[model samples]
Target: MTKSTQGFCFHTATSSHVEPLPNAKKAMAILRAAGMKKINFAGGEPFMNAEFLGQLVMYCKETLNLESVSVVTNGSKVTKRWLAKYGEYPDIMAISCDSFDETTNVKIGRGTGNHLKTVVELSQKCKEHGIMLKINTVVNRYNFHEDMNAAIEEIQPFRWKCFQVLIVPEENGSEHTLRDARRFLISDDEWRLFNEKHRHQECFVPEGNDVMASSYLLLDEYLRFLNKGWESRQKVF
Candidate 1:
């Protein structure tokens, strides 16, 4: 119901691009001047270049006067200092976490150890800093059966966004993906069962394959809108 972004750029998995993207300030200014409402700072890990990320977040909220600013992060780089420095900027901080089991998480390539623990710590920091915490989980073959209600209850995120392991032919299924989609793909029945199990949670926000395919104003690493979903990307400049 609130005003939100039409496009954003972020990696669905751990990012390989260590260097920050080009013309970030100019991009923010352009989007703002174009009447864009919210600017979400995301990507191969926005915090990889924390200084630049902080600048964009501040600029969107302060200079651009955008309605909301948000970020999609892996939670490892979100720190107390980061939240303290730019806490007021982002209206939401979404952390990607897929599984609760250590072994399953490793298989899912989310991380090697205690991914949930780190997410929980970040949640606390967000709470302390007066920021809204959102938990994002991608349902895949590896984690579809694992019940996440306990972990969700523990983190107490303002929102829990559940997504199907999105298979984009030109993206996750392409050569650029961080992990193999073959190993992660799950059946519709499996996804349905998983949803039926946790859909009752107050924070639950479901995004299925049809909904995913319908439309999203997602910007690629180059700031181009991935207009045709995952199959192709388009340049706005």
Candidate 2:
């Protein structure tokens, strides 16, 4: 339910063809007008343009006075200096760590061999800056059986979310797409098993396809509304 509180956007997809700042302001105004009080910035790795992302976070809190502003990142590009400058704006910083094992993480394309290390470091920095830390794990074929309890316990995030691997029709399901996530997808039983394994963790929250399908109101790079089902880009700005 925490996810439904915010709308998500792909920053790089929109930034490619438009002036990011103005477009961002317009989008934020529209969202605010629509009574959206919380917004989350996702990628194309938002931290790629750290300053731009920081500005948007600041504008949401200071200018629009949004109730919550969050960022979902891979944690590879985040730096201590950037956190010091802009960390105060975001209410939560969620790092994607698919697996606790470094080898499995690298194979899943989270980062190189050091992604787990980066996540740990970023979690510490977020704590020092008084920002809530969250971990997002996608339970795909490669990481379905991993026991992440020890690492998650060590990090002690405010929330630890596990998502069943979903394959959108035009996005990641087909061979033509950049990611053929068909191979990564796990069965419903596998997802249930994975959740059962971590049920003891206090912070753990598991989301299956049925829940994820209708929960999000996503805006794509072109500022078009996206639904995870048969409809793609239901509305455009």
Best by TM-score: 2
User: Which one is best on lDDT?
Assistant: 2
What C-alpha lDDT, on a 0 to 100 scale, does residue 158 get in candidate 1? 87
Error of 2 at 37 (Å): 2.3
The lDDT of model 2 is 0.78
Candidate 1 has a TM-score of 0.84
Structural similarity to truth (TM-score) of each candidate:
0.84, 0.89
Q: Over the stretch 114-204, how does candidate 1's per-residue lDDT look in tens digits?
A: 7778888888878877889988888888789989998888878889988887766544565565433655778999999999999989999
- How accurate locally is residue 80 in candidate 1, as Cα lDDT from 0 to 100? 76
lDDT of 1 at 105: 70
Report the C-alpha lDDT of model 2 over 44-158, residue by residue, as the tens digit. 6778778888998999999999998999987878888898899789999998888888888777776668887789888988989999999998898999998888888899999
Instruction: Give each model's whole-structure lDDT.
Output: 0.73, 0.78
